[model samples]
Target: MLCAICRRDARGFGFAPHLIRVAAPTVKLCSMRCMDIAARLKGMINPNKHEAAALDAASQAGGVYVELLSRTDLTTWSEQEWGRLVDVIVTEYQDTLRRAYADDPPI
Candidate 1:
């Protein structure tokens, strides 16, 4: 199975919230790196303490897009960069929903 966070092969590492009785669900990842990243995404880790370099590397390795959506240092980015980030996020969300419902019957 693909890593739920980065779309890479699971390679035997994975997480299942249900195993711990959490409502969030499960995810498979290729390495400990992705497990940490997924934890950060789920707010289980402090993003500030963990540098962005790791995330950037993981994103690049998995062909996943990265964006600084909630970064407090937004002033460092140009307006065009912000616009592009928004576009990427919106496009990704739409694509996910499309794929999710692709096989569902019409209402």
Candidate 2:
């Protein structure tokens, strides 16, 4: 696999344990620096207050990611950061759906 941003081979000797270096294209983040930058930029519109309310609403559906996506504040984020936030939220929604519907029926 290649790092999404850097487009470099991600199979270095110590890459396996980290697991992030080889993330699939859809999940590819290149580096924690990229992920953190994405998160910080997108944090503006993705305020923690809004995330908490959404988590509460999703709890009834037995979502597992209620803990991860939950935010508190987005102090200095920019509007341009909404793009990454949307990406993360969409992925989280799919993961939550799978967990909610696993084993039993949809909630």
**Best-fitting candidate, scored by lDDT:** 1
Quantify all predictions' global Cα lDDT against the true fold: 0.51, 0.38
Query: lDDT, candidate 1, residue 80?
Result: 80
Q: Can you list the residue pairs that collide in candidate 1?
A: none
Cα displacement (Å) at residue 27, model 1: 1.2
- Candidate 1 per-residue lDDT, tens place, 29-94, comes to 777766765554552322231233334433443334333344546687678866776556544543
Q: How far is candidate 2 from the true structure (C-alpha RMSD, Å)?
A: 15.3
Off by over 4 Å in 2: 1-80
Please state every model's RMSD to the true fold in angstroms.
14.4, 15.3
Give the residue spans of candidate 1 off by over 4 A.
Answer: 42-107
- lDDT by residue (39-67, candidate 2, tens digit) is 43332222233344445544533333333
